[model samples]
Target: MAATISPSSPNYHASISNTTINNLFDDSLTEIFCKLPCKSLFTCKSVSKRWLTLISNPNFHSLFLTHQHTLFQKTQALGEDLDQPSFILKPYNALVITPNSPSLQLGPLENHLSLSFLGPNFEPTNIVPQLRSVLKFVFACSNGLLVYGNPRPRHRCIYHIRNPLTKDSLELPCALTLCDHAGVLVGFTCDPYYHLETDKTKNAKVSIFSASQRRFRVVRIPAFSDTRSAFDVEVFYSETGKWKNFLVSCPKGFACGFFLTASSVEHEGKLYFMGGGRVLVYDPYENERVASVIELPRGFGEAYRGCLGVSCGTLQLSEFPISPSSAFEAYSGRVWELKHCGKGEETTTTTTTWELVHEFCLPEVVGPGFEELKANESENVKGCSRILAFHPYVRDTVFLKFGDNIICCNLLTRRFKVSKYGGLSLLFYPVIPIVIPWWPTPIPALPL
Candidate 1:
């Protein structure tokens, strides 16, 4: 018996083995690679030409992104715990803003202080000018992407949506360039439902390069005041590349007076902004230009500042009462839960109200002396704190900023822990739920 040999080499007999290897590298390999964490996938891109092409393919990226989303949602639904969210300190100077490798100080529980740094491996080509101008502000973040911009006078500001994970960013034109008003508040939110298609088998390739499919929408709510009650609402939809304007009339008692000083909270597909004495809930998904106003409990006067937050799927508002007597002292704080009372009749909208759920003094909960701060300084550092953000996955917990320190407090257990670092003007924890791999990979490191 004789075997046929190819003209190029005598290895023609290995055809059967070669065919098996080729078949194994086909779709099955792609399926496994799609499930790899983004950092690992980035490393896997250099394995081989075939591997690089497969990972870089638009279809493959779409599949991977959707798979990651599905995994996050499933884990979130299962009530799993994740690491404490990291904070990005507000840039104190142009140098701080331009640094590629920035130190992320962690406020992990206990008096422990740990320091980790993000690599200077990314190029700031898209946001260099804005970052250098001292006008850049990170208005909002979703998942791991950030919405930031250079705000200018005459109602003009250049905006950008960025993803630190991928070192990519998209610049947006000034939507309010023509206006002559001040105190305009801008916010950002990412809706994957509207951004990405769940069924990757259908028209998914086009979504890979779609900016709108990858980013969030920019919302600009007019600053209503005592004299002006009506204004145009401008919303920019990333996918459509168009701005939709809606003229909204505030109810007699409801207006976003002094909204510039108060921040807006996004929960369950709505934006909550503080008004004079009530909170205005805006449903950007709704067609009408109307926003529902929820009044605060009686005696929670307009002078008291409010921070909006969401915990355990409930809208929580914390009030900080400032008084001259306690201007240099710590005072008691209050947390209120907003309850949806009843479905409105056919002709009316949904009815909502609030109830006070918890109360605690700032000094007592944070302890008389924080380990991070000096004993002498702790006594001098006495003032009410402002709520920064709530722990995304934890229950009944919120982060507060007092003087130069950041503290995490649990309302249910009445416990508090302070971050060891100071001089942080703003803080943000990247929203990706899983702990990304760090060694030899570009995935950002976390301070354990």
Candidate 2:
């Protein structure tokens, strides 16, 4: 753990005394050590109790997160990991996305992030007591942490906030809900900045925003029947370890099934629920009303579907033109980019701006058992074609659920491949795609 050069600089051979290392001020050591790789930091801990205390401190984690958001994320190449792939920033990211974020969509992350909580091999029975069920689906994901829930009916399941990389997890209290899972819209996000306490909105009460600002939130909008009507929303703050109810309203015009079976993703500092027809936005830091809503560029009719994702620091959406199961008949998909439009359109409820990024088709497959699958499609059975998630790195590729198998299709390559993770009676839920860092984020222990 001692990071000392021999007495002769490069040619030195004498170990530096622990006394000399401990002589440095805590701040000085922190400023220097935070820049080291996570593995090196861990090894440095055995040097002394002072090193252990410095590395384990919350303040030090905050500092480490800042460094990752800036220089560390940039130096990492796309589709490649560092020599030491054991560095991940804490969950309290403050809207600081770097340019090379596309790397998050590496080939295997979508499957791993979706199934990591079941234990090392993504087995269904590999669950913690707190994670009661065999894992229904990921509620929300930010940075590298996931809010996974059980498959109990009526949304009556427990949620566990877990960092698979670090193997750190926190069990949240039962959800405060007046409706079922289909009736609710859930999102997970952590404090973005360190100074959010003083950065509260106007002179409003800042109960939800803490000073450490390192806490995460699991927000559930239980009811959304009447448009423009206010309803109770339950939010669980990690800092206080309690669920606080707040009344908020959403933009009008969308129907009830808009957010049906949808999952939330934290983008920038806000939460986005990729609804059936439009995107429902919510900001946890401010306002009793919902944040700006974004309308999709085209229709995602009941047959075809769409999924939202972030890659290369830009908001992207992939819309399937036709169900992949119907590849034998028709095959087409589209990708769109979300961007800010020109100002002066304040009269509009949403600043609608989307550019068609890519349109692709899948190569046809000829094999046995195709006729049986096609027959199921013709009968209009349930779970025909569902888009689970967009590839985190590759924009054109997407993960789709046809029946018992989750297919990873690359629109650009026109290829189809089946994942080894199937044949289970798993719930039909959207896969929560996460771009994991080299090191895993740690779940801070909340006060009991």
Candidate 3:
């Protein structure tokens, strides 16, 4: 009976164990698959039925996420050489038409899609289809997720919450109340406690799903006040699937003009909005109805453009110095960190003070000035280097726009690198890679 095996029979090869990945034990297979990047794991899913099942298993995802966290912990303990933060750049533009005559026949401009990232390796990975037809513009980034919406008017617009790493996107129905209102501003925040509630080991690696439903909070506020220094605000809660409305009043005499592209930063559960001369702070989660405004630290002029961000558990301001400089670039980088002068959670926003933390010149950061800009400084003023974005999490890092290049600088380390993304209306956000792919079991239905 032992000698009766035939080459044509499927069982004939069963006794001869093949040492391929598919034949490895479940525990061994998970260890190898978990090491691959999100995109690579997507590719490996198609290798075989066994692999697809194992990779798609809930248990596998939990283990992979645990492993990623462990690696991150180790990197953090080891310091700079290992756990440096990462960044991603995405460009956007609006569809403009004649203000007076809607039918003037000025067609839409060509849209360009360019995405690049600077990670621990410093090498940029080019993702495909840089131009996504559905992605009109990105409004905010919370954790590793992004909230993007269509360029169409409020009535016709739709918003999408996406995880760029997993390529899982959720298209949400338009929030007419939030979108239809003029001067409305949108912001996103990632719940720090989101992971604790959702970290069950049963269904971790479900593969394709948006991160929004799992752990994201989106808030909407009016930029300008109908009343003096006060605005109405609304919040979208993922857990309950509802929007909550509230009001925020800025300190007396504080005036802010939020541009179409102005962005807000969320730090320690509070949102900081940049105004003409002060930073408006909104504590959405707190019971407070009024916002507290902080004036620019003394010696920091209000004439120049400024951006707000949170880094190292403190709020920061990065100002583009409009002061006269001999360099061809009109603006030099200026950074400041907000320090709390008083204690207690009640006085956190109102009692904070700012201190100059870092500053760098364009020429020193970007190496050499562009050839054309060098020819004539005043002539190239329109295209002068400017601060584009901040490292949302880290205050010391800032992104600069010098002509066509996007420069990334780490103020603490004094290290700068020019980004490889090329597109109009450019912006960037930072992300830390992990292998947890969350796929919602009951597909979320879109509003009609």
Best by lDDT: 2
Q: Any idea how many clashes model 3 has?
A: 0
How many pairs collide in each candidate, listed in order? 0, 8, 0
Candidate achieving the largest TM-score? 3
lDDT of 1 at 43: 66
For model 1, how does the per-residue alpha-carbon lDDT over 177-294 read when each residue is reduced to its tens digit? 4433345555666553223444456633232334323434678775666533466778877666556788766564465554323656677667776776777667776643776677
Residue 437 in candidate 2, Cα distance off native in Å? 2.8
Error of 1 at 410 (Å): 1.4
Residues 203-285 of candidate 3 have per-residue lDDT tens digits of: 43223223544445677665553335666677766666566676666655444444533666777667766666766677766
Better structure of 2 and 3 per lDDT: 2
What are the runs in model 2 whose C-alpha is more than 4 Å off? 1-137, 154-157, 178-183, 192-212, 223-229, 256-261, 321-329, 345-350, 364-387, 391-419, 422-427, 444-448
Model 1: which ten-residue window has the lowest total lDDT? 93-102
Instruction: Note the Cα lDDT for every prediction shown.
Output: 0.52, 0.56, 0.53
The RMSD of every model to the true structure, in order and in angstroms, is 9.9, 9.4, 11.2
Question: Candidate 3, after superposition: displacement of residue 47 in Å?
Answer: 5.4
lDDT of 2 by residue, 1-448 (tens): 9675656685453334345656778988988886776656767889888888888876776666555545543554433321211111211111111123322323333233334344532234422452323333456778677777654435565678886544568888887654353445668886433321221545421212135437777887653444543556677877788788886665454333424235677877678776436677778767634555677786545412676777556777776545545644244666788878655656553355888877654324313434545454423233444556665545455565555445666555555565333333223334566556534555655777
The TM-score-based order of candidates, best leading, equals: 3, 1, 2
| Candidate 3 accuracy as lDDT | 0.53
